[model samples]
Target: MNIAVSIAIPDDEEKQTELSFDELSDRAKEKARDNYRQNYPDDGWWDSSYEDFDKIADMMGICIATKQVPLMNGKNKSVPAIYFSGFWCQGDGACFEGNWYPEKDPLASLTKVMGHAPNDADLHEIAFGLAHLSERCNQLIPEARVKVEHNSRYYHSNSVSYDIDLPMPIHIQEGNELQHMVFDGLRTKLDLDDEAFETEVSDLLRRFMDWMYGLLEEEHEHLTSDEVIDQYLEEMKFDEDGEAIY
Candidate 1:
């Protein structure tokens, strides 16, 4: 069920782009919604699509892609289950809602879906592309890194996403100076008796790094849709204990 495709940024000079990440993400999200409307013109998600919106949209918590490949013959680079380029992003920011899902407790960490994706699985490429963008966006916004990965599929996707140049939110060059400042601030804040502010700050930095790294897992851990299918097939051959192990 997984059809593989090679990804390219369209080296053709005519297709190259020069835009900020936010600009690209915003454009991608909007274009996706417009395309979805054109295709599904009448019966849309406004009526009861919020549920689906939450699963993928809110879970990702980032903007959409800048462009999408209209390829119908190939599988996407990531899980086709994500609709990174549709109205989901434009609907209500559900795609970038509060920290993924704050209301659910995982049976171990569960993210329910209406199904894998809608009729057009191509958006998965766009969504995956944006996820890849999240890491770059993180440097721009420190809070993004501090946010928990519990529901931020978008964040995870970005870390897993291909690397690109992005500016940091705080204007500070990389050096021991930044670390010293962070350490000093934490040392003092930790003494504020209400609860120790410095400790909190230190933890925040750690959490930020956690968010940064959470996205990068071995290929075995990053479950693209194709991988999911593979997982199912492997499961069919054996049980969880891994004797035959599928």
Candidate 2:
């Protein structure tokens, strides 16, 4: 009796023991990008960049209210109450509720960062409007107080509202005819009627909110860009199939 046996062996060149190094690297990089996106699909990645905005607001004489949060060391830290949405979508934007005071030269402070020579007419107008409002408020309405608040469910610039309280001057309260005449004349010269005053304040605040949104958008774009993601992925590791390793 005799028996016959047959065996088939796979070609060595056709078998892949592991992905090529370059291919694995490329896949890993892509996987990293996916992971980054998953972790931060929207505005979740802007915390680190928000400090710059807070500083800018302060320089512009805007005092943002702060909330106290407990730290790991059992101490409380104050964080600015800055609110924002996104770079896209109709209702997605930024706004803040805070107190604004007159700075020595707010336009200079703004230009130092937002550019000295702005080509955008709206930006130029907003800058000058805010400056002029600040000057007039400081000189005429010394006792006037303003509070900015967000009134809409959406985050667009128009959602912000201003509450400006202009107290009558002491001389006007005393009811002197001469003082009344003088006050009326000054108010007229400064174009400070109630309607005009409110309009100017509202315009300045809404425009400033728009500018804040622009800054947030620029920072968001930079953080989510491929180059930035690659920098973040430098320490990441991946397995042969491009799956991320712990």
Q: Write the per-residue lDDT of candidate 1 for residues 41-154, one digit (tens) a residue.
A: 233223233233334444344222222334457843322122222223322111221232111221111122113554424334434433433433332332332222224444
Candidate 2 residue lDDT tens string, 14-83: 6544433244666666766777767763533555646665675665567777767687799987777667
**Highest lDDT model number:** 2
Considering every candidate listed, which one attains the maximal TM-score?
Answer: 2
Give the 10-residue window scoring lowest on summed lDDT in candidate 1. 101-110
Q: Residue 2: error of model 2 in Å?
A: 20
- Model 1 scores a TM of 0.22
- Find the number of clashing residue pairs for candidate 2: 0
